[model samples]
Target: MIEIIPVDTPSLGDRSYLGTDGEVAFVVDPQRDIDRMLRLAERRGVEIRHVFETHVHNDYVTGGPALAAATGADYHVNAADPVAFDRCPIEDGDVVEIGPRTRLRAVATPGHTFTHLSYVLESPDRPPAVFTGGSLLHGTTGRPDLLGREHTGTLARAQYASANRLARELPPETDVLPTHGFGSFCSATQSEVTESTIGLERRVNPALTRGEDEYVRSLLAGLDAYPAYYAHMPTLNRAGADAPDLSAPRRANAAELRRRLRAGEWVVDLRSRTAFAAGHLAGVLNFGLDGNFAVYLGWLIPWGTPLTLLGETPGDIAEAQRELARIGIDRPAAAATGGPADWAGDDKPASMPTATFAELATVRRHRPVVVLDVRRDAEWRESHVPGAVHIPLHELPSRLHEVPDGEVWTHCASGYRASIAASLLAAAGREGDVVAVHDDYDPHAMIARFAATGGSGLARHPL
Candidate 1:
């Protein structure tokens, strides 16, 4: 029996699957989560024989080489696309045998990337299973504009043809296992479901429904912005390099950290918002080593920016380094040597501005205070506190004129965006008390308290 193990990298939140049959295993789209894949291989008593990338992924750095290094697995890519890795380039119809009975055939499915390919698993008796990386998803198709707008139309048309090829050629009963599920930026129509059948997707996926031209047009429309860091990912994957050893992550004491900071090094605090707010070294930018940590870091920190990490845990520090490497941001000066609390010094830590339910009730009972909900438009419409000005964090820098020059209480679904908004207001020389509100606090009570008592106890003044 063939066993498939899902390796979910919390850093990228990208799911990579490992397929095993006793003595041999094959890994698909191995992101930076190598330990889990190794453990899975060990549990099955198998050696990883091959590492496959469905396409040139932009969401996170590929871990194909890392896995290959640890397992002696041969890396595989599309024969058409010339990659610089030590790979066994396979064309459509090329087969990789895992055992005396089981094999995987490469199926050329270009369009997600110029050289994208899917794999079809065959084992004599049962129907085939297609492992589509980004070319074909359960409910949606991979976005066509990843390369650029110049080739978007060409790529979309190619992707459409490829999808049709699979729909027509692959058996209706083939089980389709897609790399990216719903909520992935890779596919425009990622489904909530992780797996589906070729026949089932053929009936439901919009990318497979219309004529070639119309389908291409539909795919191009409403395409969201790819993360800025994605532009550098393909090259990194092409030239597979060893990931920096995380167990021996570079560490520096407070004095060294201060020296580096002065010498143009950036301090990246990877602690959670709550931990960061409680007490953190001054001037360190908090990107909380959470979801899309690297994506935002690429935007906030300049390319090739020297970094010093202040993570909540050692694992968190390692994850920060891995995320940075995925996007080719590999230079880290060091990790903070001491714990976060130790670095805070003797100054009574300033509590992050917050309002209790009772305080909010009194504020809402009074007048003159405005709550600025700096969440996305969709979030605001879903359900938001009344009397809140909706301004998305991305738009906040440009739309500062819209916010009234009065005491403004800023909030997002949580306080993260609000803190960012508050910082922006301070930088803009705005003459208003800008306070970030934590999501855990009751908005109604805070609003009412402001109405009753005129404002929260915080003073209203310019930065």
Candidate 2:
């Protein structure tokens, strides 16, 4: 039986491993979580025999070389790309045998990248499965705009032709496993569910719905904004940038932390809510170093923001730094210079009380603290805390003057954006106390609690 293990991408959930016949494994579109893949292999008693990249990714850092080095596996890329590394260059019709009954056949499927290929898994008795990296997705094909305008027209046309070819050529019953899901930026439409079948996609995927010209035009429309750091990724991947050394986190003490902070270094705390609430350094912004940590941090910390990391454990610190590096936020000024206790100083910002739903209700009953909902318009419309100011996190810096000077309770779907907004407010020397609301709790109860106190009146409902 072939065991498939999905490695969570920093934000894009498309990285996975395909283990063949219980003893040999092949990984596809590996995220930076090399250890997770290793652990999966250990659990299954398999050795990773080869690492295959369908294409060079721009959405997140690739782990092909890192995993290969860890397991001494052969790294494979398309022969056409001419990657600068010792790798097995696979081309169409080349079959890599993994066991007595299992093999992977390379199918050249370009357009996403000039060298993109999908691996067709062949077993003796079952329908084949195609690991269609970015080439084919559930509702769409991979975007051809990665090559930019210089070749977008030509490449997009080529991509459409490739998709049409795959639609017609691959077996109707073949399973399709893509490298990106519905929400991923890699494809114009990433599905919430990650995998699909070739036959299923051919019937329902809009990108494959029409003729070449119409399909190409559909892809070009409504393409989401690429991450700011995407331009740097191609170079980084090609150069095989050094993997983050998780064993060694930058060590610092209270003095160094203070000096770095004063010297314009930004402190990013990557800890769980419970851990962060228990204790943390003053003035640090919390962007928990967990899943999607890189994507969120990339948004919160501007490019070139000198960074210092704070985490609950040693591992957390290293993981946090690695996530930052994945999105090209590589400069880690230091990490946990001193434990929270030792770093307490007058410079530490006073810890503002966070409101529970009940407490917020009491405050709102008597007086209402300005509630700034930092979620986007779509999110706010779906559901929001009543009597809240709506300013998406991205616009907070420019719209600072809109928020009143008094107490301001900030919230997003979760506390991540709220924390970022609060930090921005603090940095601006705003007089208001910034509080983050836990999304799991009821917002109405919190608002009622605040109202009961007659603490402050809600005013100036801005459109």
Candidate 3:
């Protein structure tokens, strides 16, 4: 019998797979924290004999080398990659016996990266499962333009061919396990669920349904600007991140947090948006522990910027650190825990003014404050407050000049992102002028309310 377990980091919606055939196992695309894998190996009474990556990752730091060293497993990646690390270089058609009944054969599938691969597992005792790291996802494939815009067309073509190869060669009944596309920016298109079968994909996958030229067009056109932190991952993963030191980024007190903030270190408040807006330290960004915490942490903060995380508990700090480290934002100078009471002295605790959508409607019509829709471009396109400045929260730093230099009210689909943007504004000296719409108020409904009530109150939607 074969057991394939998933190591999911829900913060980023990323999954790594470990397949075992009783005596030994091989892990694919694991995160920086290899403890989970270690424990799994120990519990199953199996040694990890090999680790494989489909491509040089452009998202999270890989624990391939660390896990390999810890388990004495041979680590492998594409030989086409120029990563300056000792790795067992693998190419297409290379076969490995993971155990008695389970065997892995590598298929060179480039497109996501110039050196992407999909590993097809053959099990004599069970049905097959293919681990398509970034090449063949549930609904679509990894975005081709992650490396650069120039290679998009070339990569898209390569992806089209690679995806076809899997569809043509793999059995229809084979399980399709992809490392990305389930809420990860790595995918060209997002998929609701992470699991699918080759038969299901054969009928629904765009690469199969759409013509080659059309697939390339849609894939390239559908691509959105990826996080800047992405630019660092390939190189870091190639070189290999040092084994994660969970003990680093030692705890700090209120004073040290203050010092870090003063020194311009990114002080991320890993609490709820509501809690953060209620009261947080002055000049801290609320990249909340709840939302896509790691993605935003990497996006808004510059690469290699010093950071100090603030959390409600030690558990929060540890979780946040683990997620952040996955994306190469390791080694926070220090972390602090507790509420505003622990961090605040005689001075008043820092807080942002928040408004409900109804209140924001009134504010917008009466005083004409800049109603900023801090949602993504797609969200704004679907619906938005008429006349609201369209600056996605990630673009706020660079597009600050476009924001009106007066009182501004911000709202996202929910208040989580709005709170973060409001805090960023506050940190950039707009504390008095930025208002966070911290309620779970629907923006379009508010716009409809504005149409019906003349911004007086929430009312029935009007044409």
Model 1, stretches more than 4 Å misplaced? 211-214, 255-264, 337-341, 346-348, 355-410, 413-416, 419-433, 440-463
What overall lDDT goes with each candidate model? 0.71, 0.70, 0.84
Range of the 10 consecutive residues with the lowest summed lDDT in candidate 1: 454-463
Tens digit per residue, CA lDDT, model 1, 213-277: 77876677657555566777777777776754555467777667667756756777777666655
Question: What's the lDDT for candidate 3?
Answer: 0.84
Clashes per candidate (backbone, < 3 Å): 25, 35, 0
Q: Against the true structure, what is each candidate's TM-score? A: 0.81, 0.78, 0.94
Whole-structure CA lDDT of model 2: 0.70
Tens-place lDDT digits, model 2, residues 312-397: 67777777766766665665767773446756555554454566555555566576588788876645654556567888877776
Model 3 Cα RMSD, Å?
Answer: 3.1
lDDT of 3 by residue, 223-292 (tens): 7667888888888887887778777468788788788888988888899987887898888888888889
Error (Å) of candidate 3 at residue 185 is: 0.5
Reference-based lDDT, residue 254, model 3: 79
Q: Which stretches of candidate 3 lie over 4 Å from their true place?
A: 439-447, 452-463
